[model samples]
Target: MPATYNTDGAEDPDLYAQLMTERYGPLRLILAERNRPAPPRQARANLTPDPRAAEHRHQLLEALNNRPQPDPEPAA
Candidate 1:
């Protein structure tokens, strides 16, 4: 089934506004709120570095350096 039921005709915009105002109070206040500019967003600054990042990098470097080496050649 369709989500919205088919209506015979389009609803009157003014009547809809009046109904909404009756239910929710003043349309002007609602319209003003809807049209108002949003508050400015705050910029997030990293005040401190992550301590674990350095430890992880150190562990990775140690693992890379400690890889197995080839055996030394025997006398001919």
Candidate 2:
């Protein structure tokens, strides 16, 4: 919650400005810029596949999907 006035009980302009700014700053920006243009995203076309990443992904998938390799053949 936020305070409506300062400790002195008077309509402190600074306090009012702060509270208003905190509560309405984001909204003011949104309303002021209806179009709200967003930054363009760059394509990762040049990024190369990481062999280690692929290997780790494969290991993780196998760990999740495969059962404990059945205890090796009984010692007998």
TM-score for each candidate, following the candidate numbering: 0.33, 0.29
**lDDT, candidates in the order shown:** 0.70, 0.66
Over 1-76, each residue of candidate 2 has an lDDT whose tens digit, in order, gives 2333233553777676677668667545645576677789786675777769988999999988886666678677
Poorest lDDT segment (10 consecutive residues) of candidate 2: 1-10
Clash pairs, candidate 2, are none
Report the CA-based lDDT of candidate 1 relative to the real structure.
0.70
Give the top-scoring candidate (TM-score). Answer: 1
